[model samples]
Target: MLEQHATELLRHTVEETFPLAREVMTLDARQYTCPERFAQEKQQIFSRVPLVLAASCELRKPGDFKTVEVAGIPVLLVRNREGTVHALLNACTHRGAAVASGCGSAARFTCPYHGWTFAQDGDLVGIASSTDFGAVDKTALAMKRFPVTERAGLIWVILDPDSSHDPADMLGGIDELVAGFGFAGWNHIESRTMHGPNWKLTFDAHLEFYHVPVLHRETFGPERSNRAFYFSQGPHQRVVAPRGRPGDTAKDDLYALGRLPAADEPFDPLLVGEWILFPGASINTFYLNGQRGVLLSIVLPGPDVGTSTTTQTFLAETPPDEVTRAAMEELCTFLARVVGDEDLPTSALQQKALATGLLEHVRFGQNEGGLQHFHRWLDDLLKADDAELAALLAEPCPQR
Candidate 1:
């Protein structure tokens, strides 16, 4: 399935043809500006759907853990001694205070506020002052645990503790291609968060490359392709440009495949593009000084309707040397500028305009199939109940 998509892209590139959707679509602008709608999205979509919180390599060893907040819910991801990953509510059972923050190795978390301790598996192992605090059932006071699954080198967690939905089902067939990347063995370099506009507004830019040439002219350059071909597997999508800047490493590598005498094997380089994990995450291929790398961007909605934070994690296929490390650092800095100065600033302005009630609808052109699919899925997910939502995701992905 992965190689077949690569072949399709190669064919499109050779034919100089990219398919477009049947018609343009319009979405209610208020979906991006209304507080009531944002609240529903938080509960229905953000809370219900499985979210990609970290790559498997981020917690490769037992006792490694990372903490992140999704839709205001603090989540702690940990790996136990037996090499199993678990997701727990970051709050301590004692007084709802967070037992951990940031990422590091720890056998147990001792809450700073009261000294309550929790094992990596969320077991309430120790109480600060057993006699003074009084006797209680430690079993009943265990940290809240959420359903979590690790697959295709990524870790997915459902914020809802009782959710019956399988996190793997949400990936659709995207895991096939992601597994090809062998991200489980990749080295985690660095991660940083950047503040942005509304979650939807910030994520909208990642679904389409229409504004790439104009918005990213200074960074990606004006010669870069403004057109892209979107392929979907369930709610996840890949933004593939049939053609792009001539000097782009991935593009050059892809075009070079056509020159080969016999292209029997799947050329891994051809699979390079932007792969978006639904709700809010994207993995974009990159090469630093000839070393393969990917930028995994996860966007989570903030406390209010008009704010979001994107955590960008850079990973390399192997440990980076000094030269490769320098290149990776340079690339990250450049991307920060491209997204912070260009993409997000534009989205923020759009949010401001939409908030004024001047525009009732936002139009997505036929070429913007990715955005159309995303908005449609979001609407459906928002309307679905627990059973309906599971049934919706369980349905097979539509064939392109």
Candidate 2:
């Protein structure tokens, strides 16, 4: 059972607080970098749960389709004539050849190796030599399909047919948390993908603001202070740091560098809000004056252990003008570079050490309460017997 105090605190923070307080803490890195644990995590995290497979933006119109690889399974996502999004196994039933090549508009997909075709809805439509086969049941040979659902502008897929789980239930407290940000009206402006040492390692680097004063001194150091940082945890974990006053010493350098616009009005008081959604999504909010924008990052497991991909989406209330858009792009690019150039190397190095038995376990601190909560959830899932796991999957998300 979830502790009563933790559950209450989560409900209040996610529902009531706009900029909540921060608690300093740390998480043991050993669990993530360990090879034996990584194998267990694959079955627990990737196979047992539904994951975001594609974005709705990729299949915005009928006949549009996109192909993606999910944990080594080739997936084809298509928008049928009725406009519903469907996910299908990409293999042709004839000889398991992939029916489609790249993202494009297609009423139907035809296998090039042999002449087999399937409709956008996964109906087997053709066979190269029907006469050669003696009354083969075409309906029985239709391409396989996977369960898919769309929410918050992204498409989610369940790989295991026998696994009983509800996507909404798995989303936990994120629905209310996202609704609180008024994101329904926001438009998707851009998306970028980056290769990382490990998805969880990259997430760990972003889960706390403790690194800002030290690791990000060259970039955000002048505009932010360690004392201004605050942390909160619930179903979602958040760390916030307000920009210092205009005339503070830290402000002079940031202003002189022309990175931040001169404070024409009082600081909006909400400078930065970083939220870590359970499982593997991170949402960030940035406030300059009264202008605000949100960045959402989703990390997914790749084909094997030690590899993963991070997909980021930038969104805003209004479509940005060239200048504003450029700034936003630059901001995301800089952050991506920091992760790729700095964090990835360290994480990879740690993975190597862990593989060689150099590290056994990692510890978490009080401020890193969010990390602790996340690991606890992981451990719970891993340790759960089959019966307990099923019960967890069936339970409804806690009410706000």
Candidate 3:
């Protein structure tokens, strides 16, 4: 199946045939400006969906844990001695103080407020002065566990404890799409957070390369092609430039495929584009000093409608040497500047314009099918009830 997809891309390259939507699509500017709509999205989409929370390598060993907040919900992720990952509400049962903060390794956590101790599995094991605290069912007070699963070298967690939707089902086989990357064995180098405009606005810029030549003209535009081919399985999508297209960083290496036998074609070119795990995670491959690295960009809703936080996590296939490490740092800094100086500042300006109520809608061209599909899925999810959501995800995801 992977080879077939690669062959299809090669054929498109030779034919100059990139797919397009039926027509131009327009979205309401208010989708990025309205607080009520943002709140609804928080409830219906962000809270209910299985989000890409952390890379598998972040907690490669047992007893490793990390804490992150999603849509105002504090979550604690721990890898137990049994090699299983668990997601628990970070709040302590007694006074609701967060028992954990940041990432580190620990066998157990004790709430600072009253010394309520919880094991790696979230069992309430020790309570300060339990004899004086009175008899309470410890089992009933175990930290509330949310649905969590690790797949394709990433950690996925749903915020709702009672959600019927399975994280695997929600992914719709996207794990297979990225299985070639072998991300579980990767090593996380570093992570940093950057502020952006509305979450949707920040993510919209990633869905299509239509603005690459314009918005990223100084850096990527000169050598890259603006054209792209989008392939999707459910809400997850991969954006690829045709084989030998200048947009591909390895286009020179791919040109050899034209004369090479089909069986001899390399598989690396097929994985050379952006892979988006929906609601908001975009994974892109990069190379520095001849060492491969992946940049995982996770965008989560902020405290308000006008703000969003993006965590950029960089992972390398193997540990880097001093030279590669320096190159990686340079590359990371360059990307931060591109996003912070170019993309997000423009989005903030767009937000201000839309807030003025002067522009009624935003336009997406026929070529911008990715944005169309994303917004349509958002609409569908927003209107679905819990039961309907289960049924919706249960349907088989169509192949590209």
Candidate 4:
């Protein structure tokens, strides 16, 4: 499916407004600035959604773990000795202190505030001065757990403790699409976090190509195309834009196949594109000295409407060699500069400007279908009653 569409996308990009949508849509600027709406979204969008937390390769071994705070909820994502990833509340059951911080392999997480220890599975296995406690119920003291699904090289979690939402519920058949890239086999190269504006504003940077040639021109080159081809599956979106001139399909077997070139392929060319996991995540292909790398990223909301934190992780088919390491560092440095020096600073200013109440509405053209899909779904979910939400949740996602 991607191959067929990629071929079509390459052909389409030769023309202007290559993949136009049905209509232009305008959103109220409040969608970017209203604190009340932002509060509702924290529940309807961020809390309820199955969020992509990390790549599977980031937790390939037993005891491997990573921690993140999503929408102000601290999460401890761990791979147990059984080789299953689980999302547990980072707070200790004893005194409500954080049980862990950062990422690494650990035998058990012991709270820094106290000596309370928890296994990767969230079992409250040890407590300081147990004799003094006099028969506390260990089972009842277990760390709260959230639903998690590890699929297609990604770890997804629904922050709700009792959530039934699986990765399939949010991703539809997108996991099948991602599985083709073999991200699980890739070696982790870099992982870093950056501060940004409101979560939505930071996210808006990932949804369209309208600013690509202008905002990213210094890094992306002069011939980069502004036109984008968008493919939406339910609330998620995929974006394809021109990297350079389209490849000659008949000139080689790889291009003829209309697929993204493999890591070892002599040439890494633009073919199939990038993805936006609904809410605030993105999976994109990267090139480091002509070698292929994969990036998985997420923008997380902070304590309120005005602040956000972003984490980006890069991986390669294998651990980098000396020359490849230099290339990887150069590519990552360039990405950091373009995002920090360019995209993020501008988005942060947009957030500040939106809060001034000067503009009541903002417009989105056909080119911004990704943003439209997100905000529209948010509106629908916010207006829904519990029953309505359940029925909507049960509705089959459009895989095509």
Pick the TM-score winner: 1
Write the residue-wise lDDT of candidate 2 on 330-388 in tens digits: 88888777666676676677667665656666655555545555666677778876566
lDDT of each: 0.85, 0.63, 0.84, 0.77
Q: Against the correct fold, how does model 3 do in TM-score? A: 0.93
Instruction: Give the per-residue lDDT digits (tens) of candidate 1, residues 1-400.
Output: 6556667877888887889988999899999989999999988988788899999999989999999988788999999999999999999988899998999999998888999999999999999779999999998988999988888899988898877777777656567667878899999988888898899999999999899888888888898888887878878888887765476655226556664324665456556678888989999888766678899999999888999999999999899999889889988988888888888899999999999999999999988999999999898888888877766775657733
RMSD in angstroms, candidate 2? 7.3
Candidate 2 local Cα displacement, residue 292, angstroms: 4.8
In terms of lDDT, which candidate is stronger, 1 or 3?
1
Error of 1 at 202 (Å): 0.3
Total clashes in model 4, counting residue pairs 3 or more apart in sequence or in different chains? 1
lDDT (tens digit, per residue) of candidate 4 on 121-226: 9999998999987799998999999988877788888888876556455556667666777777888888889988888889887888888878887877656767
- Colliding residue pairs in candidate 1: none
| TM-score of every prediction relative to native | 0.95, 0.75, 0.93, 0.89
Error of 3 at 271 (Å): 1.6
**Could you arrange the candidates by lDDT from highest to lowest?**
1, 3, 4, 2
Positional deviation of 311 in candidate 3, in angstroms? Answer: 0.7
Q: Which stretches in model 3 have alpha-carbon errors above 4 Å?
A: 221-223, 243-266, 394-400
lDDT of 1: 0.85
TM-score of 2: 0.75
* Deviation from native of the Cα of residue 161 in model 4, angstroms: 0.2
Give candidate 4 misplaced runs (Cα > 4 Å).
10-17, 242-271, 384-400
lDDT of 4 at 200: 84
